[model samples]
Target: MAVNIQKGLAAAGLAPLHVWNRTASKAEPVQAEGAIVEPSLESLASKCSLIFAMTFDDAALESAFSAISALSNKSKETENKILVTCSTVAPSLVQQLEHKTKSVSVLSAPVFGRPDAAAAKMLVAVLAGGSETEKNLVAKYLEYTTRKITRLGGPAHTANVLKLTGNFCILSVIEMLAQAQTLAEKNGVPREAVVDVVSALMPGPIVTGYSERIARDEFDVGFTVDGGLKDVGLMRDLASSSSVSLPFADIAHGHLERQKAENKDLDWASLAKIVRKDSHL
Candidate 1:
């Protein structure tokens, strides 16, 4: 995802892109696209006016932010630096970041897309928090990497909550596809036939894509069940706080639990396996 973001920015004529990953080897690939791999987060923070973090989860984001925050304290250069997080995190954490990082602008840009969509620059971004100027600066470079950007305005946590809810919706669709395919196969019909029928009716990416993914057993890579669980947990928390109920999320949560036990290595779309198992297929 980082490499593709850098590649898109470079293609847009954004120059001297700087990238740093906890694992230096993981960042080496971006260098091929003309980005300089920095030795430390501090070094990267020092060089760039805006720093974008695409962390895996809360802990990863915290670690990355701490490094940048520390650098901001010691150097005058990063005082006005904008910290844009593209991670899906709890809304509370986003608020905390806004509170703690007085010197830096914290903008939440939680994205929606699988790795394939990311590589294709088809990701949808939701931007929240920071001044209008700050957001425009962040969006300028981000526009190169995303299909569309939605600005939610102020209280960066709004973007994080929305990101969690978006993940819940995607997970719910995956669960629906899983159950639908299971029923089709149990009736002695092929899952591909079900996929074709759905494609003709609705013809959207999440449905068509997962239907194909489930039918072909191409669940070896991409978003993991563990990753899905983290996002689901966040969404559930959001639902609870807002006094709203998400029954599909509850259902998906149960399937994900089974997924963790049996199909942990497969891509999260393999939540379909649980439906198949329930039918004793």
Candidate 2:
């Protein structure tokens, strides 16, 4: 993730690409690759006209913005500065960030891709914010980072909403794969064989890519088990708040929780392995 941000910054030709990480040493690799390391988030936020953040969740985002808020008044008072947040957070929380940094324009710009996709600059970005001038500034900056940009709605966390909804679709596929592969393995069919059949039928990136991992129990933490659980929890909360019932989401959330209970170190794909082992497959 740090590498992707560095690559994007280099590609965008941004000067003094300052970065701050939770751990000091973690930013070393990016620093070695020509990114300037900021000692604190406040320093980073104060110097830039545009600040782009990609943290883990709402709490982290809020913490970063809180630091930014502490320094907001020290900078120029105009709305010339912009914050392009690329984290997958709750819409309501994003609204809070915007309200806190009232002088800074906030743009919700969440990305979709694995680490490799991000490094290759092939990630799809979803942008949602008002201020056409701000959007253009952001788009110009991101042209070197992503293959495409999708603009949704203004003054709303539309990008985060879309990103979460997109994850639900992936979660559905994961649940189906877990159940179907478990059935196949129990029936004495080779997991690889089952994967091949599904791959041929689906012929899409998600199916083809995850099928091999499920066959080989390759649930490494590019996306971790804990993270999947977090998303499922958030999705369920969103559904409940909107008065919608999501049964499949309920099942997926259960699988994630089960994996977390034991072998909590496994990746998101560990949910499939849980079903496989449970079914004696």
Candidate 3:
């Protein structure tokens, strides 16, 4: 994802990109692509006016923010710095970060796309920030990274809420596809035939791509089961906090847990396998 973001930026003529990753060697390739690899998070934060972070979870985000906060304090240039967090963390955590940090302008811009979509620069970015200026500032750079940027025009964390909800919807679609495909196969219908019917009806990349993968039993980890579980868990927590019920989330969560219990390293679309197993197909 980081590599694609950098590549997109470079393609858009945004040069001298600076990047840092926990695994330094992983960033070496990005450096070879003209991005300057920073030795540490603090160095990256200090050097870049606009910094984007795409960490795995809240802990990683907090760690990155800590380094950015330190840089803000040390440099006394908080007003000039903008921190754009692209990680799909809980909205509450983003709210907490905004509340805790008064220096740099923090924006939530979680993206929607697979790595391939990102590589193609077709990612959709959901953006929210403290102000229009802040949002616009980040949007300038994001324009290069994503195909579309939708501004929520509210607090920074609102973008996180939208992102989580959007993820839940995607998971719901995956579950539906899983169950539907399983039903088709069990009823003496070919999986490809089912996919062909759905492809005509759905006519989108996600449906077509995932359906093909599920039909071919090609669960090559576009998104891991663990990652899907994490997002579903986040959705469940958020839903609970808001007194909303998500039965499908629970079902997806259960499927992921079962898959994890079996110690299977599988893609998220492998949720179809749960239904396939249940149907004895």
- What's the residue-level lDDT of 48 in candidate 3? 84
Best lDDT goes to which candidate?
1
TM-scores, all candidates, are 0.94, 0.91, 0.94
Residue 116, model 2: Cα distance from true site in angstroms? 1.2
Best candidate, TM-score: 3
TM-score between candidate 3 and the true structure: 0.94
The TM-score obtained by model 2 is 0.91
* C-alpha positional error of residue 202 in candidate 2 after TM-score superposition, expressed in Å: 2.2
Worst ten-residue run, lDDT, model 3? 73-82
Candidate 3 to native Cα RMSD, angstroms: 1.7
lDDT of each: 0.86, 0.79, 0.85
Candidate 3: clashing residue pairs, number: 0
Off by more than 4 A, model 3:
4-13
Across 1-281, the per-residue lDDT of candidate 1 in tens digits comes to 77777777767777668998888888787888788999889889888878899887888888888888888899876687888999889898888888796887889998888777878878899999998988888888777668999999668889998888788878888898889888989899999999999889979898898889999888988889988888788888888988998899999998988889986768888888888888898
lDDT of 2 by residue, 56-113 (tens): 8888988877777667766565335677788878887887767665676778888888
lDDT of 3 by residue, 1-281 (tens): 66765776777787778989898888987888889988898888878878888898999999888888877877676445778899999888889888676777789999999777877778999999768877887887777658888899788999999999889988988888899888887888998998999999999888888888989989876888888888998999999999998999999899888877664568988888777788887
